[model samples]
Target: MSDAFFSEVTGRIPYAGLDSTDPLAFKVYQPDRLVLGKRMEDHLRVAVCLWHSFNWPGSDVFGVGTFDRPWLDARLDPLVAARAKLDAAFEFLAKLGVPYFCFHDRDVAPEGKTWADTQRTLETVIDQIAGRMEQTGVRLLWGTANLFSHPRYAAGAATNPDPEVVAVAAAQVRSMLDATKRLGGENYVLWGGREGYETLLNTDLAQEETQHARFLAMVAEHKHRIGFKGMLLIEPKPQEPTKHQYDYDVATVRGFLERHDLAGEFRLNLEANHATLAGHSFHHEVAAAIAAGLFGSIDANRGDYQNGWDTDQFPNSVDELALALYEIVRSGGFGSGGFNLDTKLRRQSLDRTDLFHAHIGAIDTLARSLLVAAALIEDGELERLRAERYVGWSGDLGRSILKGDAALELLSVRVLSGDIDPRPVSGRQEMLENVVNRAIWSVDRAELAAIGTPVGAAGRG
Candidate 1:
């Protein structure tokens, strides 16, 4: 396959070829034929979480004390420069070839602005931004409900013990959902940053979870009433600002959704950094969601154990990286969802361009990984090996699966099974090496030249 094959998915030409002026909405690359067994550039809509850039001045204070003093100080110059700062932020993202962006409502709210005033002011700002987004074909992925902002929410938000505070949290999310629809956003994210408790003696887990579900149900009802056609992406973090949150992991959240019968309206926004914080592989996190049929969106950020908490570093590890791509490939590729980079820069000195570079590099790496995954899946080797590994299984369900039958048939067979090696015939390390190398070679000649000549080009000559 060659560039001709790439045209199949990305149209007859790359997205860049569609409208050169609005590069932000279509920054895609043609894959090297060597990478994805077929020549194709998987067109993806990438987004940067606005929190990373808009709140850079407060990087040093993350995981520290409350921002009541510095943040609420209406006299501060930077605080007063909210609109100008946001304009610059949007312009910056636009130049990076990113069309979609996510933000927290609190991040853009004017200092000392009452919650009601914030809502009114935000509508005006979003209307302006929406026009620009429409012109550029960019859209918001909806902002988060920063329930953590109010001291009143110190206990919790929707799950707060105080009924008034709980109502406030729910109302805030309702406004956000409405704002999201106004901006033509396709989805909303719930991070649950302040929905946990430190002591069992002081909190009620059952009430919290129930109220949280009620809150989501009402939001869904509101959307239905308004005829909104977007999804609610629930991001699961094992631990963070709160210890042991209700949506602690993918499995927990998946179960919650099923029990509440809200699985159809909500899905997981798996975050690599959040997964790492929970001591699990990011790939594993996505795999769980995929298996449960609830995988919705992604929070593209890398975490480091040494960094402490959710670092939101750009993804770089080859293993975790490949898994991320493979998970998407197995799911048959995303259609219209955006890759929201839920990350932040702790280093205050890092320039705006540096953030762009990090996003560019990470996205490019994942694109290449996607190529490798397509090859592996298309080769039929993975499925073939798995089938052979389960040959002659005693369990009826296992036998059925090995015999190319339905999985549900084995519900009757408990431990009646033969020993089947779960390991793949080929190691993942070797698989990734082959995939990455092939991807590198498949990049277009123009991109290759721009990145400097291939390492062994002299020999090719």
Candidate 2:
């Protein structure tokens, strides 16, 4: 594929270290740099999502499309426009030097009025995308179906009251799965966009839950039948367009998987913005998912703390991401999972160069965070302190309680007879905070010097 879309970007983005003042160059995201005995690229495995980068036209509830995209011009035919978009997407990915990309069936192809037409359009686009991937060595990280956009799924998809609508959704998912397998995608994601109700007064909660479970089972069985080797991930979001989403959080999805007998087949894809929406921190969600052994992937983006809605802003906080990466590293790192930048450009960022700037910043932020996390692990003080705090859990009493060998009655008898007076111990919260702060500050100081920022001069002013 020719670099027709981003002709201005010239060649591939290069790692120029931190001293280079060029805006287009990567300062910290050296793909080949080793971290924790693995190449940075291998550890990060960042993938750009098409739905946000290519398909979204910077339109929101109150405004019309504000960005200029030739592929999305009204003058172009639907299929021709879809092909142009795919071409542009590949060029963008290649220029950015991203190893992988993700897309929804609808993001790559325009959905036709008829079901047959929709499938044919999607297949045709998939073939084109496959060719581009083969040529550029860019792999598909995952593929999904846009079940929430159309009016047909306003009520819900799999959890819809109407069986016909649910059947249609199943057909769409089947086609998406087939495409994913054909493209050698590493994973397939199901994001329940409208799989919740606006009001319980008109909804059948029990029936909806049962229907959702059955729907997941059907998809899992189909995945097995097709002999696809990719992981199946369910992304959790507390609520947005609906009052309550079924896959509300990591714990909720964990229970749901166990209930549906799909625990072995499906895992949670944690999203930072979604975690915030669920009234939790990003690291908290990652830890929860990792603890349950369900951490499969990440949708890398941050939400505005002041905004209640999904802002989907490009993540810029090195401190926040460093903590999240710490948990990710402690969990043995991503096996079949990778970070997908599920973020969008702000409406004001209309220039083509803004896309490059946004991605470059995000990639560098994650890379720096990975370095900080690695340093924290190497120092061992943080982990040692944490383990010391949980020393009671490694003792005989803790072991007996965990092994189910000691019941509440026995513990009560021992407590009463032994006259065991437990004294409260300080958590040393401030001291631990200082340790983390010092580590982050050390990294920040080093990075600033590397980037030619006079650290002491700024403070002296």
Candidate 3:
């Protein structure tokens, strides 16, 4: 576990402040620095994802693998390679000082020839991972079942027309759910990769919807039966492998949960790239989820603006994430959820140090964004303006209308009789944007360091 594979990165990454020249040091992410009355690490419960960091072979559909990972080499025995991968993964996690990690069932273990063999392999790997967690104090943020990669789920998992395929999906989910409980994961996530129709010609919309709802209900029941104390999360994406997905966005998932009577059991795991794909901003999706009280977790990645696909690149721009973090702050911050780095290294970034570089930059982006969000909240002008804009809602007429005390005839008579001439006013959108800009620019490393941190804590190391 002591830097088993990543030989170059020695010891844990330290907070070297904003002026540090060292690439391996954390510039803005000081875990112990106080933000909004709590330690920075407690506010941003960041996690490293196993799938993209370890399992992905740096190969796209058009090319061969380019990474220098011998553990992913197929010539070696699967079990031995898996063990090696686990060792390296733990080393990276410990050195990075991340509190939690996430994984898919397939990401942790290679699939075997038979179902029983796969299960056993997964169990062995899970045991190894548990031991590593105990040694390093790194916890599982969540665990998921990869329902789309295999041929058995080509059509769909629960929404498949074949009952046997649906049963297979159920079995996989059950096994992974049990593994999550065994690992003491904080949440369980469901990513419906192909749980939607490609074409209407052969799709029975009503039947598929019913089947999906039933499958979710069964999973919820199993979670309770097993006594797993974790939040149930579902991710939303507009489309990728399929033409459309049921969980397209926060609003769509909210309606689906309401229709299935499963609103109380699941929450939304928002992703920045997925939000962009769904024709919305990350801020818009976070706001939507917060409004519906379904905000649970986030997958920290950004999509390419030039292209229309999920790029899954590490976040770099604070401006892109500030408003979204603002929404998270307004909603009282994450409860059982955290920011999991669901990102990939560029194909050309094959050097071992690039992994640390990617994560370090993304973590700093979120850290700076938290500062901007806190400043906005403390400023009071933004919220005050919002409240003033809606001040009329607190009036007697507004209350009566909402209470159903004013009928259409009564309202029309009042409007006609009373000289109630209403006119539209400016929303001051530009002014508000300027205020946010001010908050972003006004945040200073010196000021932040002065609050609850040792002198020169923010200085160059």
Candidate 4:
């Protein structure tokens, strides 16, 4: 708003077609473009993550902060720096033209000495941020508590052995929930960053689980008490800071919800990288949650296959994303959920303008993936094949089996008397892969035509 935080990056990013040479322009993410009877913006609902974009200092375990972000300079007063970061964050979102943004309590403000002081600081900074959101029309996607970053939470937050620490964590969550509600956030996320133990010797597994359940119950009760019209989302990460997290994956979280009777109050905010970390593909995670009727939001990012840890890299794989988006679309798209870019700039990408490049690339990648997915669904070949594969279920025997009318003894008698033997069918995996590839190529050709570029002249690389 005030002379753009990234002054070098001029103009609002436009959908300049795939042939355009401008690095900052989007190649496929046309906000108003119709895809499956909905505008791209409505279908994707992309949101910028304030923590990664504004608060992360490019510091990793191997190194200190290498990026010279002015707002992160230690010399500035914490509150003043917080305000500056918020200003830049809002400016970035406005320039990117994304409809929504998200943040953590500590991301928007400095954590002070006392709980009261921290609350005051967060409220003050949130007031400033609220004004900016009003001016720019950028809505809050969600807000969360930074329960894992501080040293006090090293042992764990909700699953900590110490009741005092757990109580403190509860208070922080309460404040964050209030802030999220006040800012009109559509959802609230609870990520189990350090909610697990490093070793069994030092942990009481059953006790820890009880504490975790109580903590979530308290949050759900507060949500009802405050009348916050936002869905509560639990992000499943197998592990990172902790050895093994309770919310290991979509299936694990669903079980926990049912165990604690919180299924109605909480749904999942599935992260792409987290899915990979849990030894599952991104589509698998989305589909699992969708099947359970618990899929709600997404932390849209990717992880390195070579590395076992969560790299949080911006997603670039078209095939992978196309499949993931297909699952999201099949689930009827997000209800209260949206695609929040929970990604950060690579350490080498130190320039402030790199932020624009990173976001633009991710946006285009997802847009293209959506186009391919929609084409696949509209063509109906894949769905038709899948349904045909299960066509046996339409028969009387299959119906009897599914309806619990076929007992094992009756099935054995029928099989023995009829001398029945099942024959295996080829899965045709390679052919299915080719089908997807053809769909992707079809979308690519259309994009080339829109850009007026010859297929041979346009280099994908």
Identify the candidate with maximal lDDT.
3
Q: Is candidate 1 or candidate 2 better by TM-score?
A: 2
> Candidate 2 on 3-77: residue-level lDDT in tens?
688777998999887667899999899898778799999889999999988998889999977776788887899
**Predicted structure 3: clash tally:** 0
Point out the worst 10-residue segment of candidate 2 by lDDT: 452-461
TM-score of each: 0.77, 0.96, 0.97, 0.97
Better of 1 and 4 by TM-score: 4
RMSD of each: 8.3, 2.3, 2.3, 1.8
The whole-model lDDT of each prediction reads 0.66, 0.90, 0.92, 0.90
Which is better, 1 or 4, measured by lDDT? 4
Any runs in candidate 2 off by more than 4 Å, and if so which? 444-461
lDDT of 3 by residue, 1-461 (tens): 48667888989999886667899999889898888898888888999999988998899989988988888989989899899888888999999998999999999787899999999999999999999999999999999999999998888999999999999999999999999999999999999989998999999999999999999999999999999999999999999888999889999999999999999999989999999999999999999999999999999999999999888999998998989998898779999999999999999999777899999999999999998999898888999999999998899988998999989999899789865778999999999999999999877744555555654455535
RMSD value for candidate 2: 2.3
Residue 44, candidate 2: Cα error in Å is 0.6
C-alpha displacement of 281 in model 1, angstroms? 0.6
Which model, 2 or 4, shows the larger TM-score? Answer: 4
Q: Give the lDDT of residue 243 in candidate 3.
A: 91
What TM-score would candidate 4 get against the native?
Answer: 0.97
